[model samples]
Target chain A: MSSILKITDLHIAVDGKPILKGVNLEVKQGEIHALMGPNGSGKSTLAYALAGHPKYEITGGDIEIDGASLNELDANERARLGMFLAFQYPVTIPGVRVADFLRHAVTNRRDPDRKEGENLMPMREFRQELRGRMNELGMDPEFARRYLNDGFSGGEKKRMEILQMAMLKPKFAILDETDSGLDSDAVKVVSEGLSSLAGPETGVLIITHHERLLEFNRPQFTHVMLAGRIVETGDASLAHELHANGYTTVRERHPAEAAEEQAEREETLATV
Target chain B: MSTVTVNSAPSLPSGFTSDDFEVFLQSRVEPVWVTQRRRVAFELFQAKSAEELDPEEWKRIPARAFRPEKFSLTGKAAIGFDTAQLPLMQNRAEFEGAVVHVDGSATESRLTEQLAAKGVIFGDLATVLCQQADLLEPHFATKAVLPDTDRFAAWHGAFWTGGTVLFVPKGVQVDAPLYSLVALAQDGVADFSHTLVILEDGAEATLLEETASGSPDIAGLHVGAVELLVGKEARLRYVQLQNWNQKSWHFAHQCGRVEGNGSLQWTVGGLGSKLAHIHQDVHLDGRGAEAQVNGVTFAKDRQCLSYYTQQTHNAPDTRSDLLYKDVLTDESRVIWRGMIKVEPEAQKTDGYQRNDSLLLSPTSRCDAIPGLEIEADDVRCTHGATAGRVDVDQIFYAMCRGLTEHEAMHIIVQGFLQTVTDRIPVELVRETLDKAVEVKLGIGE
Candidate 1:
């Protein structure tokens, strides 16, 4: 049976302020979903919420895999359950080599019940797999010995995220703005990398602003979020139309939600 | 020999007194010069012990509960005690020489005949001083770690029991490295083991030393001193791993001096002790001298570890770099006060000192202060100190990659200490430090 990630009326808040209200989405295996929205529309919030970020409080609604709820799980537990998030800004852990970090990550993902201090995957096996993955992604094998993301360029950071995604091979992978802050060449590399990684066994949710990414992966479902709600859901054309014309028409079409977004903007402006 | 237990019966003197000093003196057989030096040092110890400690260095460390009289020098050697289990660098590599001291008495001392034939002296201080009195008389307690520096220095000078001494003749290089183990086997026994390394002009050597307790719950006291003297164009690498049990009090005055064009690489690992305070000093005494100091300390539970370090450049074209990394957890506290001093004649000198600390728990605390006193107008001196808890974002990032929270923390802590570990060039030292870190984190064998 193909695994399904179901988000039912998810109401999320940050520091006691509501951000995601009554958001509903469903993604099944072998499918690609695109999450598009204007700024502050909770696109990244939804991504972080799904990844079990401690700061993103799920005040209401349930996020489930198949039928089991992930409300009580932390990020590590979620990761062990085959939920992966390719961060918008991948964190830099100094003095930690890429190979060592991945060995632990891959070992934990492969053996979910493994306790701390248990043996990791053998070095020869893990190194071979990592080297192969790096080669497939056109990365220099020497990059595996460098500190994890420390002093990496913008494009290199993005590619590192993709590399982690490829290595973990999660059941459901969420790319949270993986293409943002990258040049055209980097975007192409990332897009191509994602294209090769997502297959029949994986479910992908690409939260992005650039149509360049969707142009390659070609999402089957495009959902537009405004005022912390998914105001519109459509096929590929909807994404292309939104990308070409921007969200003005969508705002006009959803007056109530757009008004709420406008009020939120003004309130944020007032606080600033 | 028989073992004498002196830890019991509080009716004895509460601290080091005139009677204890005399008794300690009578127990040792040495030359008249050594006895005269002890008399001077014993008077200094008495005076200094009565005076208040410098508040600048002792404000953060609470020593009011310390009862020095509870510990005494053992009259007889501790026999038949096994020291094979004390970890760190033992049986890990081949050494040119190895020395073991138990309860402030030499239990074993050996040196490869090849090195001994090459005019290298490696043995206990008592044996070496007796055999080579004319050769060692000038350098012993005279160049570095002066007896008048503080109470601990004077105390160690007056009553030092047994220690390791390594002397390499001019133009000779001892390549395989030497090992020293100082073990405390009896409760309430004070082990004042002194280490002195002297390398003549154009000579080179490396010495690795460690201190450990026979059992985890035995109460011990260590008032130790280490003096390293490097001659012109000579090089020396010294590592001291302080791995005492939690029921021990460790006080040490360690110093090193580098001559013209000589270099000293000093690494200190502070892993164990209930309370430890070390005053470390490095002197660039001649032109073009250089020194590199590395410190890695981990404090857990209710332990308190403090370090007062100074780097003094006295000649032109001198250089010194110091880096200390500390990790504290539970209710432990770590304090580091560092200074770089440049003399007026030391123009064009380069000095740098930095200390970074990582706190792992809410109650764990660290106090780091870096200062510089530069009288040379044409010198570059920089100092920095930073103390922060482990970044939650870094932890979360690691956790997202499938590590449990504890494992993630362990990895981050290891990463934090890797910067200083990189500065150490010895593979044996690096590997031993890694294993010590793992054991301290409660994760490895």
Candidate 2:
């Protein structure tokens, strides 16, 4: 499998409100790329649009896995092609235990040709692997029996995301603001868990607003986005630079583009 | 043994009238009380003009599925063929005994000698009526469901046949469930059935009753009645599953009475039928009594099903809780109207009821109506209702995990229904019902 996710001049909108405007990026296998920007910079939108969310229309450009385009595929069809997106806020589904839900996902993800009504994995093998993953992530085995993300705390939900990631082992995975709302302790635990699961076979795109998540995974490449476009790219030190100086330096480094975007926003506001 | 052949056996596009009722009575030689009750109900049935029964409550129910005259009252269920020859139920190994009624007759039955030695009588009501008149005379149509309640109730009283009665003596507890299958084996046949269950003081038992029909092409009529009496501290779990074909129309009145310290759990599943109107009510008449009415209904195609339920806390310290969930697809429709009432003398009564429905198609409809009538000051009563489509985020989340759209929706829908199906207690029955739900959703084998 060609473990690379290619995006070219991507543009997206939510109900006709354009969020990602002319964005370009590439994430290759064994590389953890960090996309850091302020709130409303469209980091989460890019993540959702990549995952084929129906609400986020892809009006321009394309996203390709390997050499094939994903524009025509539905979310589940895309999922079968080895793509996974952990939501900023995982949806709550009550009365469905975590173990059962994960079993369905694991089988479908692993066995591309598996048919419905046939269990993908046996109970014994699934139970052993699930418990092993839960223990590795410091998750109580009891959480597997609980309803999926229903009434789960912020820390627990993040842990659940990591647990699913460990189980599905997707070819390409995107973590969307997974570090938000997590305490320092939870961040440390979740970061360590993600690090242990990351390797050469799986490409990852980590979208975040701060450097707290970068401290654990320590991305090799950092891209700073503003006004729905990537304005700066540098080595790992760029994360510390942005953390130390915040977005002021990044904004000053691209003054003309910043002013152009500012004038466009004012023009749009005046028209409204 | 006596058998009666009533009014002319005719084919469809016709209906039942007063003359048919007269012929039905003339053909039978029953006790005076039975005849008198039937006469009273027949008169009431004849007197109910379309306008008199035109209350807003009955408006949602469409015109009767089949006119009465088109159906033949072939007498107490006497299936010309043995019920064992039919393949309706599977896994009969767990039951202590079983009874099967088809085409208006009891064809196959297994009443264990151990149960009979315990003085437990389980069989067709017609047979029980002849052999145990003392037991049937006082309690029949007297306590749980009255004979003169409505047109359907009176019609069932006048022409009911092929019913079952389960009587458990004081302190007798059956270890395994007693199974009964009432099936319609032919087209244009009407079945007016009654199921009576009585548990004496300190008695306990479980009954799994299944109601089904032959196929979708068989346009049948079923007007049924069920009465359950739980004596002091007695316990009972009754599971009623209805799987009629789309060509069948069903209307039933089911009621239960619970005495002091007794508990009753009624688990129902409605998976078939073209159009059904069901009325279920439970009365907690003694202190410390409790009753629970939990059910799941899955409907597809043009099926229309409505349930009107009541939970009456008539004694102090009594409690009643009900939860009814439905899943609808295609152009199907569901209506749920539930009321919880606390009497003035029923202090410290706790009552709760709610109905939730999931509509898969935009054109499908669900009307969930919940009401509370509180006459006691020291009572806690609450009613809740919700009707909405399936959650898109839930579906998307499932899709993200590798399930196809249909698979995702099916899993989520099954989970939505498992909230009630999981409480069925019997492992085989629960799995069977789950599979039935999947089939209704057009998924799984």
Best by lDDT: 1
In model 1, how large is the Cα lDDT of residue A244? Answer: 93
Give residue B31's lDDT in candidate 2 (0 to 100). 72
lDDT of 1 by residue, B80-168 (tens): 78887776688698787999999999999999999999999999998888999999899999989888997789888999989999999
Query: Model 2, B177-225: lDDT tens per residue?
Result: 8998888878788888899999999999988888877655887888899
Q: DockQ for all models, in order? A: 0.70, 0.63
What is the C-alpha local distance difference test score of each model?
0.91, 0.82
In model 1, residue pairs whose N, Cα or C atoms come closer than 3 Å (at least 3 residues apart or on different chains), thus clashing, are B14-B69
Candidate 1 residue-wise lDDT, A1-272, digit = tens: 99999999999999999999999999998899999999999999998899888999999999999989999999999999989999998998888889999999999999999988789999999999999888888899999999999999989998989899899989899999999999999999999988997778789999988999998899999999999999999999999999999999999999999999999999999999
